[model samples]
Target: MGWLIFVWALTACTENPVDHDIRPPTTLEGEWLVTAINDEPLTTANGQAGSWLGFSAGAEVVRWEPGCAQLMFLYTVDSDDFRADAIRYNVPYDKPIFVPSKFMPPPCAIGWPPRLEEAMEAMSLARKIELTQSGSVLLSGEGRSITVRPR
Candidate 1:
């Protein structure tokens, strides 16, 4: 009876199995300037400003500013996982060209900047967020990737 009681006490004091599936929080709030895509450096062309991304904490939204117009995306971040859905362009209605008319659809309906489209595609496909040693953030998915630096 004494040996049986000792064995039961030891089993009761044993710890449960540890859970290794927990992930670390990914810090991705604030503005970030696009620096590279797929390991290639990005540059401003024809005197045009480069692209950028803005993230607001607890907002679940991300804004992509690519010189001409801003594209807003509905996004979710879970630990190191990131996913974005293309919503719509934040076009200014003050501009007559941007306003939808019977003759012309909205500017977004026509087309978007090539760079902006590329960035948006990459973001939408992004599945992982990695922090670089150089203080840059990398979003990668499949064969595509986007690198950004805090502004």
Candidate 2:
């Protein structure tokens, strides 16, 4: 009986070979550096470049510093694709709503409220973000792409 079971296992293994070279998806749970954006090499008018990006594995939140603006959004994931909605909090603006202040969150924050949503759309359209196993390619519906390496 044991021999019969072993034979079945052997047949299964022979029929479906395993690809041991494949690694799992990268855990996009920590900090990611802004290597480049919109294919322009992440430059800044004020010399404050290459913003930081953060992802919270526990809350499905994405923290982005596109320039000097810190924006937070709740994103929905379908496989490797991500769909993020309106900015939940515009760090520099959201916190200063009631005050007459000229304070900004950080240097990474940039863009006015009028154009911020557009930026969000552009960012999200890169629909899918595949990590280490796939060499971290960002694919957009309009054929635009962004590439990032683990930092």
Candidate 3:
């Protein structure tokens, strides 16, 4: 019996090793920075910029003005791919909402109401986020791509 076990082990070792190097999907779980946020102008005066909000790897959050907040995405793993629920603020207009207000929840006591609520819903139904482990590339909804580096 022992010899049989040894023989099986030797055979297994001679065969190809399992492909443990398979790449995993991108999860944008940690902080991410905003390089750009391009949006067509609804009107000549109300043109919006890149993402309304952006987040750094740690906790540095940035919001674009005259535009939506940059995206500060925190991902949740769902089977093979990763999912995130991020909210974009309406620049300075909604910055006050992020502060502790009389009728707001602890986490969002100071943020804007309509924008935050709308973003929450939009994020849920937003397109899928994809990443390549090797290069840390971020794929946007319209197939737009960005290269990400770990901090």
Candidate 4:
């Protein structure tokens, strides 16, 4: 009886094998700096030029500032599915919305940065978020993708 009980206890105490095939979805609840656009590497110069995204999981909001303007989006995520709707701000045309009042150039002078335009277009088209093996986040859709890394 003692031997049988010891055998039973040993079997019961054995650890279950971990399932390496399954993994929890990656989270998108922190600040991320843009690293690439459509597979093209974004240089430090271009990244510094302004291209970053921050997500607030609690608030369900994502904020992106791309050089000339600040943009906000209300977002939702389920597993790998992700969606974002731009939050429009009613700006009174009388005020200057450009950053750094002194060094405003062509695009900024016009109140629209070309990079911002491209980013907005890509974001609007994005419908999925994927985690790369390298730990970067890829937001992609309609053949366009934006890769970002944790800040």
Candidate 5:
């Protein structure tokens, strides 16, 4: 009789299970490589947007890797919302340089927020992060989708 009551109480306690999935960062500092934006790769080669996105050409690929240095993006999290700002870090002479040509389409075409001054205005619009069952953190808003894998 006591065992049955204990089992019932245990089951009742679990009626509303707690979700311990997502947690904040202890150290969110350092540049996290934007591994993939939407479904397009941020790799050095083939820096164009995926065809499904229908973005026009002149899409520049920004690399944070050793050789080809483009844009070093900075990210910040406020509670659940986060923003990634593009910072033009001076590159070593040995590495490939990124020159902003006037005629080219803006960085936003390639899924980057924008440079410092403009990015500040852009960052003002906070976007929330959603955690998936597979443990991937999704940052999506304003017709943009990014899958961030912190490096």
Candidate 6:
């Protein structure tokens, strides 16, 4: 009788915790190389908007292995948020380098809680990192997606 009660209590106490499948940052810590990026189309009031420059590109690729550079980007994962993580570039450079010639003040900036508060307000609706892949991770909100890959 006591054994049965003990087993029941143990089972009741052992309800699996919330699914935290998004493993910790041990494996993803070091450098990561960006292989590819998918640029989602932008929509305007009229319809699909075209770029003034007439060309579009996604995240930049950097070298991972020494003396042998491929279509990969290497950056240190300074912080990890299953929802909204960040990676500091291995090579230090100014933000201005990313500015487009057509834009006066530069259309946007990197790093979270972006330069605009309004955008964050809109992004608040998206799911906060339910899961992460081995080589890739995603942050989706306000219909915008940011993908990260390993080096």
Maximum-TM-score candidate: 1
* TM-score for each predicted model, relative to the true structure: 0.58, 0.44, 0.30, 0.58, 0.39, 0.26
Tens digits of per-residue lDDT for model 2, 1-151: 9999999898665412322354423334555544344443443456675434423332466565453454555666566665655353333644432122445334433444333343345555666555423344343445544444445
Better of 2 and 6 by lDDT: 2
Residues 11-120, candidate 3: write the lDDT tens digits: 66631222225544435445443322221111122554223333343332222121233334454544334344444344344454434334433443234422343333
What residue runs in model 6 are displaced by over 4 Å at the alpha carbon?
Answer: 1-20, 24-28, 35-97, 100-127, 130-134
Q: Global CA lDDT of candidate 4, please? A: 0.58
How well is each residue in 1-151 modelled by candidate 6, as lDDT tens digits?
Answer: 9999998898666322223565534323435332212223323346654211111112322322221211132222223432321123333343322233432333224322212222222223223332244435443455554333443
lDDT of 5 at 108: 47
* Candidate 6 CA-lDDT value: 0.32
What digit string (tens of lDDT, one per residue) describes model 5 on residues 1-151? 9999999888666422222366633223433434345434444436552212111111222234332223444556666666654454443443322444443333444443322222222222337555544444556567565544444
- Model 2 TM-score, 2 decimals: 0.44
Error of 3 at 85 (Å): 3.7
TM-score between candidate 1 and the true structure:
0.58
lDDT of 6 at 98: 25
Report the error of model 2 at residue 124, Å: 2.1
lDDT of 3 at 7: 90
Q: Which window of ten consecutive residues has the lowest lDDT sum in model 4?
A: 15-24
Query: Residue pairs in steric clash, candidate 4?
Result: none
lDDT tens digits by residue: candidate 1, 1-151 = 9999999898665333112244423655677777777766675666454553433333576766542343567777787888877554443444333234554454353455446556666777899876665667778898898777777
Better of 4 and 5 by lDDT: 4
Candidate 1 lDDT for residue 127: 91
